[model samples]
Target: MTFEDTWKPKIDAYRAKLDEEVGPYKALVEGIDYSSENFNAVEALDTLLTEKDREITNSTAKQLVAKQRDGTLTAVEIYNAFAKRGAIAHIFTNCAMELFFQEGLERAKELDKYREDHNGELVGPFHGLPISLKELMKYGGKVTTAGFVCYLDNYISNSPREESVSIQILRKLGAVFYMRTAQPQSVMHLDTDNAITGRTSNPFNRKISPGGSSGGESAAVAMGSSVFGIGSDIGGSIRVPAAFCGLYGIRPTTKRVSGLGSLSGGAGQESIFSSQGPLTRTIDDLEYYMVNYINMGKPWEYDPNTIPLEWKTGVSLPETVTYGILLTDTLVEPSDAIKRGLAYVQDKLRDYKGKKVDVKVITIDHDLMKEAFKQTLQIYGTSKPVHDKLFAISNEPLLPLTKFFLGFANPEENDILTNNNIKEQFKYYMYYLFKDQGIDFLISPTNPNVGEVPKNLTHWNYSSMFNLIDFPNIIFRTGLTFDPKVDVKGPTNVTDYNANDYVNAPINLQLTALRFEDEKLVEGVKLLDKALELA
Candidate 1:
């Protein structure tokens, strides 16, 4: 059989399954115009849901768990609310790869029964919380395509090869997974558009990207479809989506969260490994997920690569903390919206100086950043042959972003050695930079621009630099949105890259701390998030 002949049936079967899962919620999404170029799904459809439904769906994960534990809400009610809203989000943005609402409802019923039997005691920290997963993560007896069409028919065995380590941990903590979100083909693009599920658009502005690899999760959470969701990032996958969609997300240092059994494009490439973390609307939820997943999940016991590190809570920062501000990467200047957001934070910090925090501008080595970006491309390019073989299985035409990534030739051994040397040298450079400067953390734009139009995305210097250096980073919304009149383009002599006018797009700032200092990073982010009133 030809590749098309072999893959057509598999693709059709998956679509049929998705239809079947969403069939029950057809009435909920009825009368919704899915083809509108620009519309706010949250404002339009939120009123369609009952106040109770809205309350449960919009509550943070911690709040939901508290309600469930206190007998004020049931897991089944929470699951049904999110499931219906998630179905609507799928219709609007094509963000869901798989929906198992029936399965989720059944699990919720079990949890409610357990809570009743145990005298209103909760099962775990995440009890009764509706959490979504990126399609790349393994779900027992389910298929994980990771946006690769060839893997549509590949399913995990029900018995022994069931869940990924991260899923297993979340399951044990009483989290309910009703949906698997969409991602881009090859799972390497900054935007989430794939042959199987199409593209996931921003909830705020459908014409622009939701941010990828984790775009679907961001969109779903932003629209209150799920309280929070899991997103894996090697190069700003989680943070970019969260920033674009006006949410909160973190990319922890590698191996802090177990990746065992999770499907990835560069599975064995250790040059820059991906780390999984939560993407939520609230910073507290981000903290809750990280703390519980590490301390309660005991990830090191599940994945050998994970370090045996305890999750430290209540980490006290110094009364006077220092922050280094990075205005530009020198490769590309941030848009007006991003510049305004940075200035807003700088002014806030300056006002708070001597009372709480200290702020200063720190100059970065543009040459070193350029080298790091090149090295990142080389590391990512190593997976080209693997991706080629996967696509060849079904003879699927490469997606635009996939083709763009593969254009970079793989580096030779000597080049790889040289890149490694550069990485090590840059790592120490940052280490001493922080120490000599007495900077607790560094702040910069999550992306050069707020958000981009689909298929026009490029420039990962703002985020990829940290990925190359293996530092933990968090993206927090600055409570600012793009305005055409306010964010007009300035004169530029540079010709290589041109900034796009992102309308109504959210602006976010990224905060980075030293390697393996994930806890400190989270604490620092909470402080900044509060100071900025970004709750």
Candidate 2:
């Protein structure tokens, strides 16, 4: 049978399941036209949202929680507003793999009742806040296909004890799960396209991708349907989508947040283990979720793999914060838009009065970076066998990006032990650079291009390099957008340059720190954001 003939029925079955799961809420976006060369989901949502829906969805998670605690807003009110917006967003961007609005509403009501019975006291830190989830995570009673068509009917347990510790923690802290976002076919690509949901488009620009495998979470948050969402990153999954969607996201050091029940191929591959973190509209929310999740949730008790380290809420910045900036990863040169953003940040730091800032333009060891990049691919490819087995079950054809990834996942790859040894050497080399220079943080571009052109993103050198070394990194917008005429590509080695493709795509950068220094990294980026006047 041809690929289409074999996979068509499976795709139809999955879509039917999604429609059944969403129920009546599916009708909210039934008549909308989502096909267009140039479409903005956020703007399209603007026309659909009511005045109240606009106000509720516009507020940050912090703001919503504050209001809920103050008795000004009810959990049910917040859920309803987001339900409408999330449903609309799913239609416009194909962001949701499943929507359980009714289930979410029922939980919201329970929370509201709990607060009322407790004499107006709050439930927890994240009281009444709704968090969209990446489909890979194990949610009780939900089918977590992890983007494979074969697992559509497979259901997780309905018990909280069976869920991911991160999910368990969030529930304890009062988080509502209304929707699960889509991901790429293999959950290995840097763009979102699966046989089940087709593709998740950029909220800012429909023609381009939001980013993958957490691309749907980024799109859902960017579209204002979710204030914050959980996403996982092994390679560039979390940070790339956040940068592409103009949001704040973190790829915390591995085992910081429990990866206990998260679903993905390469499950036991430790050469580059995945880290789960929150992606949000504001930088404060990034820290807000992490601090509470670690300190309040205490994930280590549930997941033995989790580190028992506490996240320090208040990290004091040093008198002088030294930043090391890299223009290129020496693999793929950053586009003109990203270069301008780095320059803008450099200029801001040079003139800032908030703190004593020392900025240095440092060149990374190109050879070392190349070695790390090579190792990351080998480590990632080790899971190709797992993916091959899953795809064979449904006879599902590989998506464009998955096929590209399998190209690197060579069958003749070196053993995992060799890769880990090389990874250790690479980590020490990076650590020595930080120590030798006394650099507080390493700032670099989030992606080679400012915005992703769907199915065209081929480089992960910048973001994935951090994954290779197990460093925690946070993505923050540069408060700049691509200006086609002004940010035109100058004479360079990039052969396929198009200024028009990156229209209005925000330029963002990654702020990284040494391994297990996630708290300090968040604090340092907070300081930098203030200095640059970026909210």
Candidate 3:
């Protein structure tokens, strides 16, 4: 009885089986018996960290439509202060999968009757704001359950899309698709969970983890419950839940946001690629919706598999840059709150903009980048209709980290024929680390523990090594703050993740860019997100 008294009764019988599967969905999603009447909510939020019109809940659907056309606010009181702070953030972070608060009260009374019959604005720039998505895109009549259950009787399809091009380019830029999220049964796990929404935690620390196949839209826009969303990424599933629930995501590159009618666990193993972007909480709302909603919704002349190269915002580098830190890794080492949040972004790029930055914490010879990120997640779970519908979803019981990694996912069925020889050694180690290391983008430590615990996300192999170097990464948050007395453990660390016991978890702050350089990683992290005021 000694391995912490043998996993403390298997962590107290899975903490009473996750409080009998989250105690009746936390009393039917947080009206928790209206706490015996007149329940005041707008107050239950601060935990996800401040807001409800004190602004900056990572604003930016073009700065909430330019403060609802400069009357300073009121698209129905910013839609009743983000729907009363996203209804107490889905009643304390279950981070909903589809609630649409009665369709956000009929789209905030039709945007307050078109701002009271056009005496003012909003018919674009995400008008009323509020965002969220990650259930493999496509909404109208929404239902995409990527977390499998035979697509939970799959929905979405409103006659139109005469052959969808990201739903007619985000419906000609209006951008207001309410809900559709939750994944990880055979979306091939990063963390979410299935059988109808299981995991998705880390609204800061509901015992860790939020990252996954876009962990329920990175825990619904990191608990501000959708100030932005829409995700997809092959391995680092959109920067692993935006670096385990801190928030910002990007994962652009591949096709620069356009997977036409998305949906992909493995729909056509299509060259270890996979993209589709956005998961915000602002880096100016991920470059104002990837430069006015996916580069002015060009979508490569309507998805000929986009990439006619559009979104190239004004990037003025050369203030003396040369980043390439990996904050400890002899196979992994991040956790003194992500090595002091990557040393607070290398001292805000060398003392809050004096510039001349150049970190090189190198040393990741993961012996072939860890077998090319486990053969690119075995050719990304080579879809067979999500492993034959997770054994017809119902038999419950497989989460001990999904029998610690697909429990022989039926005796390792030839690990998807060596995922194309590990995708040519992960595209020749991303052309030998970006054209033989001229070093422009490669900062590490996005995972090795930052958000975990709930079913313990077994060290999400450092953001799946940028999905085996397919690049295009960004997950900002590093507004660092988790002080266990300046984060412990050091005694001459000889690596091997400095004696791992879950790489010391505790997060917030993770950035990675290049390969379609997310508009210079959102203008070098919005100048350290305005010197760490974070938005």
Candidate 4:
């Protein structure tokens, strides 16, 4: 049989599974045409939600939790609202790889029953929250396809004990998982596309990408189908998608949160470690999830790789906050929209009415960052042998993006040691810059562009730099959107990002801190959000 004959059946089966899981909810958006040009799925989807659904889905996780605690909203009611919106989001954007609506609702019902039986005591901090997960996270008895067609039948454990450690913690905290989001093939591409579930579109503008490998999560969160979503990041996975979707997300210091049970390539590779965090609509909600997930969950006790550090509370930024704003990585310059967004932020910081804040234009060490970028590509390729085996198992054809990614893999692991040594040197250089300049935090572009056409995202230098140096970074929207009429192209030699193609895409910026300064980083972003009046 031909390649399509072999793989097409698996794709069909995977999609069939999603439909079967979605069940009756499919009728809500059955007749809508999703092929229209430049469709605003996020806006269109909002109208379909009932007033109650809108209220539930629009509220942040913290708000929903507060209502649940006060007995104003039951777990089942919240789940029902999100379930309807999430189903519509999936139909519109293809954001969901798997659906567990029945299971999630049942769990929500149980939480409500428990509350009724116990006089309104919440089961956990995140009681009754509907969370979307990236496809790789194990959810018990579900297939954990890490975007590879070959692993379509690899079902996870059927017991709660076998769920991903992070999932287990979230479950204990009363999170209901109803949807699994999409990722790119090989789980390496910065754009979301794969053979099984296809590409996830940007809800803001269907013409462009939602960003990946957490693209589905970003799309879901942006569509208001989810209050927030969980995503993993190694090289711009979480931050890029969050930026592309105009949401907030973070990549915490490695091992601060457990990644156990999240399957992806590079099982034991430590040259560049992956970290997982939330994608939320508000910075306060982002902090809420982190503080509760780490402080209350205590993931280190469950996942051996997690650090023993508790999520710090009462952490505050320095008296006179110093922000080193990086205009470009000197590798790929940011687009006009991003430049405008940076200028807006700089102006806001300069005009802050609060405590002392200083904004200084800083230049990055291009040679050093370029070398580190190359090292990251090589390190990523070391998992080629393992990925090759997965592809071979089912004779699955490589997607275009996966082929492009594998092309950068080293022939062997010989250079891994050298790659790691260079990483250490780069980290030291960055740390010195922080100390020497007394920089409290660093601000930079989240991507070269606001959003790229699907399967066309390039230049990850802005986001991947943090992954290389193992720093914690948070991505937040600037309350600005790309206006092609105003965000005109510059000299054209500096960037290849065409603003005309990214109309209505939100422009976001990155806030980064030294390694293990996650608490302080969150605090700093909170302050920056206040300065900029981000709601």
Per the 3 Å backbone cut-off, how many clashing residue pairs does candidate 3 have?
3
Whole-model lDDT per candidate: 0.83, 0.85, 0.61, 0.85
Tens digit per residue, CA lDDT, model 3, 1-535: 2323433344345335434433433533443432322122223455333355547454667667877777677655665565555545555554555555556657757875787698886676666766666766756676565655445456777744622456556645555445556766666566777645566555655545577777777766765656777778776777878877667777777876677776654677675677778787667667777887665777877777677887776778766567677765455565566677777777666555445666665666667766666665555445554554553443444555555555322336446556666766666765566556666666677666565544545555566656555567777776554554655542122233222322323355555665667688677666666655564
Q: How well does candidate 4 match the true structure in TM-score terms?
A: 0.96
User: What digit string (tens of lDDT, one per residue) describes model 1 on residues 130-245?
Assistant: 88999898887888889998888778865424568888888889988899999899888889998886778888777789998799999988877877789999888998998899
Better of 1 and 3 by TM-score: 1
- Residue 310 in candidate 3, Cα distance off native in Å: 35
Q: Looking at model 2, report the run of 10 residues with the lowest lDDT sum.
A: 490-499
Model 2 C-alpha lDDT per residue in residues 177-270, reported as the tens digit of each score: 8899998998988899988888888988887789888999999998877767899998999999999999999999999898788777778887
Q: Give the runs in model 4 whose Cα sits over 4 Å from its true position.
A: 1-6, 30-32, 159-161, 410-414, 490-498
The C-alpha local distance difference test score for the whole of candidate 3 amounts to 0.61
Runs in model 3 lying further than 4 Å from the true structure: 1-59, 69-105, 110-127, 136-144, 147-149, 154-227, 232-234, 239-282, 286-322, 325-354, 359-372, 375-386, 391-463, 466-524, 527-535
Q: Estimate each model's TM-score.
A: 0.95, 0.95, 0.32, 0.96
For model 3, give the RMSD to the true fold: 22.4
Error in Å for residue 307 of model 4: 1.0
Estimate the overall C-alpha local distance difference test score of candidate 2.
0.85
Residue pairs in clash, model 4: 381-409
Candidates arranged by lDDT, highest first: 4, 2, 1, 3
Off by over 4 Å in 2: 1-7, 17-34, 159-161, 411-413, 490-495
Which parts of model 1 have CA positions greater than 4 angstroms off?
1-3, 159-162, 410-414, 490-501
Backbone Cα, N, C clashes tallied per candidate = 0, 1, 3, 1
